[model samples]
Target: MIGAGMGAMAAAARLAVAGRRVTVYERTETHGGALRRHERDGFGFDTGPGLLHLPAVWRDLFVKTGREPLEERVAMAQVEPAVRHVFADGSSVALPGGSRAGTVEALDAALGPGAGERWSELLVRAREVWDATRRPLLEEPLTGAVDRAALGRDPYPARRRGLLRRRPATLTGVARAELRDPRLVALLESHALAHGLDPRRAPASAVVLAYLEHTFGTWYVRGGMRALADAVYERCLERGVEFRFGTAVSRVVVEGGRAVGVELADGTREAADAVVWGAGGPVPAAGDAGEAGGGTGAAAGRLTVLLALRGRRPEGTAHRTVVHTAGPGGTTRTVTVLRPGDPALVPDGEHESAVLSVAVPPHRAGAGRPADRAEAMDWTAGEWAAVDWTAPGAAERCADEALAVADAAGLGLGGRLLWREVRTPADTERETGAPGGAVPAPVLAGADGAFLRAANRTATAGLYRVGGWAHPGGGTAHAGMSGAMAAGLIVEGDDWRGSR
Candidate 1:
């Protein structure tokens, strides 16, 4: 394996369970890419997958491996306020990711009279789209030559039943055709862009995002997500998977278009029959400046964050904040805040929920280019030793933006003291080797770029990739499923299940 992030680990776990000797080569010490556990000043937080959704996916992993999952160690509680949206009027609404009836009711109260009925109708429409797109587009890989004729014939059934049309060609058109409320449309489409693709112009299949959230539901893990990672790491050991820390991969060594092994930065190479690109570093962009010597376009916007909370969380009464600050330079700043406790996310806890966050549209560093996956995480133990976790002013401008979001949510922090930390997108990519500082395939764009994400599969043979950086994008579940899917392809050679 070239990277031991979530995808790699899940893949390794699969191969190892099948009585295979799998040596994972990770450039950094950590295993889970975006799903890493950071501990500073006795406080531990899961910097990735802060919110859990699409549960059946993980349940499927445990069933596939016959090995218990880390889920046993952690409990999941549906986020009561699945998401709290506050506008400039100081008016706020909590959008719980469940129940058409309740959500419809909430919509009626928040939007207008018939909005509740509209919500139900939209849910029905979303379900129709999900039933058609889930398998063909999301389950199967979209790679090889773009044979428009052959690709369009896929079973994802982009063609709806008379009344509607399912098309992967355009995003905005689909939205215009289906949703009437601009706010509702924004809510439906925002889920797609979470992964990095601009949803407005993406594709119709991306609508699966809204469908999945509403259909499957969303939740927060009790006692933090770190416990889950540690548990998985421990379980992998029970299955006899060996892990080495503090080592970095120099390159994925390929011979004659075949991946034979990985080269470590320290100049060591390990041989293996198959290699998976779990840690596919930044998918290079078009015109990033900092990327000249950094390798690719994806390297320009690398960013990661670590928000260490000081004093107390918003007193019992919760407040959620998601802020979008359009910088003068055009770069956008985003700060997400989750209040401490809700039976769904955090349990009756001793510590307040470490407000989770991320900033999109990072400042472009330089210009060099490639148009591939955006970024990946490279974790090193030594690097973790050097950071100043106590400083909150690291991204002063971003911090101020976060505060503004709190005020917008009608939250008042009585100014107490404890801890504060910030990591720019550059900081995250540098710390974790997440190329472009991209959030692990957290949001898989639909609409237009869905086909392009199939790049998760490498150009070389015997090399497979899993993790947030892969095609389907990020999610502990997506990473885990992707890893297993690739391992299945390798184990069965031509007979593997789930292989496209």
Candidate 2:
């Protein structure tokens, strides 16, 4: 394994249990890739994902790898009123978790009569899309030649309106045609944006993203999401998987048209029969062999602000809140505020820790230059200077914008905040080695398969891909599934379809 990310570690554990000696070489001194935690004083915050959806992925991992189940490894519970949405129009609604009827009732009560029914009807269609693609997209590993022609077609059953037989093809189109209300549209679009997707370009099948959360329910593990990462790392150790941290793999050693080992950054070569490329960016020796043919489209990264507050967390507070604001050019922007009531996160009962996050364009050298100047610059300029996140307080400014939105939604953190830490895409890049900190979005079927990640089985024989950068794409659940699929392909042969 090339990295000790959640997906890589998951694969390492399983492969070890299958009687294969597994070794992971991580560039950083940590195990989790993006699943990192930040601490100050006695306060800790999850800088990566704040919540876990579709935990069955991890449950299956534990069940298969050991006698102990996932629940025994970590403390987790469903977040009630899964999310509270505060729209720009000053209307708010708290949707109950895992209960379709409850969600409908809450929407009707808050957004007026019939609104809940409309939302429920859309979810019904989302279920259809999920059922159609769940197997091919999530459970099975993508073949060398993916059936793009079939999978490229949107599975979302958009209802036809008027005399014309036209149906919405994109997520934004569905929001306008079916959702109707602006607030409802914002609600739907927020899900896409949160996953680094643009609703205008995302396929209608992306509705399944919301469906998965609603059906599986949102959950938070005690001591932040990093605890889940720690559990997986511990599992790998228990399975006899070896991990070498602070070590980078410079290239995969290829011979006779097959990947036989990896060359370390220190000029040391480690031989192996098979290699799993789970790190971000690019596979060293694959030569674009595993890249998605049509590309996965433009991806965005996250800007997170960790706030330490002096006041006690109010009782009955929703675990998550999404504050929607109108962006430039009529676009909608959202900042998600997370205030888990876990005691392990705060210094004491009198203090609280919260996380605020928003999606932004991935970092690029000179990408932040003034638009007019950028248009005038030479196309082949040499080594443009790196984006100065600190100059003029760029990260702080972005965090302020997000905090303002959250405050306007009634969070009122300004008066209680003790200190704040801003994390930008540059920080993410430094930590995970993902270029520009571009977080990969989950693979969706549509737009001629433009959003799909590369297949697990690469053109280089004996070299496989796992993690968010590969098929099935990002999200904790998807990453775990990627590991299982890669393990199955290696142990059971390429003929293995998936779990039956």
Candidate 3:
């Protein structure tokens, strides 16, 4: 494995169990890729995803690879009232976990009469889309020639009585036609936006994203999401997988158009029968992968603010609160305040740890650069570690803006400041090796298959791609699923159907 990311580690553990001598070479001296943790003054914070959804994806991996299930290794609990949405209209809605009816009731109570019914109806359609595409798009490895007609056809049903000539094909369309209320529309769009997607352009299949979270429920690891990564890493170690941290892979060593090994930064080469691109570090020039062109555009970046407060989290506070900031037309700017259900995140009972994550647009497009994906920012290795977030007080200013938005949304943070730390896209790029520090969005079914990701089976016979940048696309669960598919392809050969 080229990198020890979540997907790479998942595949490594399975391959190790399958009797393959798996070795992971990570540039960083850590196991988890984006599932990172930061600690200061006894306060720990997850720099990556705050929570996990559709945890069955990981549970299945643990059960298949070992006797002990995932829960045995890491503590996890469902977050009740999963997320509180504070819309632009000043009204808020706290939606309960894992209950469609409860969500409907909450929506109706907050939005208005019949609002619940509209959302419930939308869920019915979303469930249908989920059932249709969950198999081919997710469970199986994408083929060289994807069935554009099948996957492109949006599964979300259109309203019968909508003021339109035909059914809406995009998420924004569905929100406008079915959810007339702007608050409901904002709620629906927030799901896509949270995943670094533009709801206006995202296909209706994106509805599945919302359905998955609401239906399966959001969960928090006992310590942090990083704990889950630690558990997976431990499982891999038990399976005898060798991990070489602080090792940088310069390129995949290819011979006769097939990846035969990887060349390390130190000029040493280790040969392998197969190579997996687990940590999509840098795009190799053509390689044997036939130019590697089909991959989706550059990804959006996450801007997170970490807060260390002197006060305690008040009783009965929502675990997660989203305060939608006012922005230009069609732009979704949300400041998600995450108060982990796990108390271990805080320094003590009196202190609190709150994280604010804002999905910011990518840097402006450079001259001659594709407008869709921009790699305008220039960064070098080790720059992220010494990033001057305090230069001109940008970090503090951003934190104040987030806090102000939160206060406007009825969640006040007045006079509770101790200090704050900010992580930008440049930091993400340096840490994860993602191009342009862009965080890729999960692949969705849409017209022209525009949302399709690069095939796991590249042109190179032995080289394969996995992780958020690969087929089935981004999101924690999807990344893990990509690993399962990659391992299945390697173990079962090209004819492998998938893991049932």
Choose the strongest candidate by lDDT: 2
Candidate 2: where is the Cα deviation over 4 Å? 286-296, 369-391
**Tens-digit lDDT string for candidate 3 (1-500):** 98888989889988898899999999998988889999998788999899898899999899889967889899889998899999987889999998888888898899999999999888888999889888888898888554655787777776566465466877888898888888888888889878777776788888888888888999888999899899999999999999999999888887888788889999898999999997664446235544453332635667788888887888999999988755546544677899874568876799888888866533322312212111111111112122233244434455566677777777666578788888876677788887656677877887667787877777788888888888788878888998898898899997787976
Model 2 lDDT per residue over 158-266, tens place:
5657766665889988988898999999999889988978787899989998899899999999998999999999999999999999999999988888999999999
The number of clashing residue pairs in each candidate reads 47, 0, 0
Provide the overall lDDT of each model, using Cα atoms, as 2-decimal numbers: 0.54, 0.84, 0.78
TM-score of each: 0.78, 0.95, 0.92
The list of candidate 1 runs beyond 4 A from truth reads 40-42, 67-70, 146-178, 282-335, 342-353, 356-358, 363-394, 414-419, 440-451, 455-457, 495-500
Q: What is the lDDT of residue 348 in candidate 3?
A: 78
- Model 1 lDDT, residue 479, Cα: 69
Which model is ahead, 1 or 2, in terms of TM-score?
Answer: 2
Cα RMSD (Å) per model? 7.6, 3.8, 4.8
Q: Report how far off residue 71 is in candidate 3 (Å).
A: 0.7
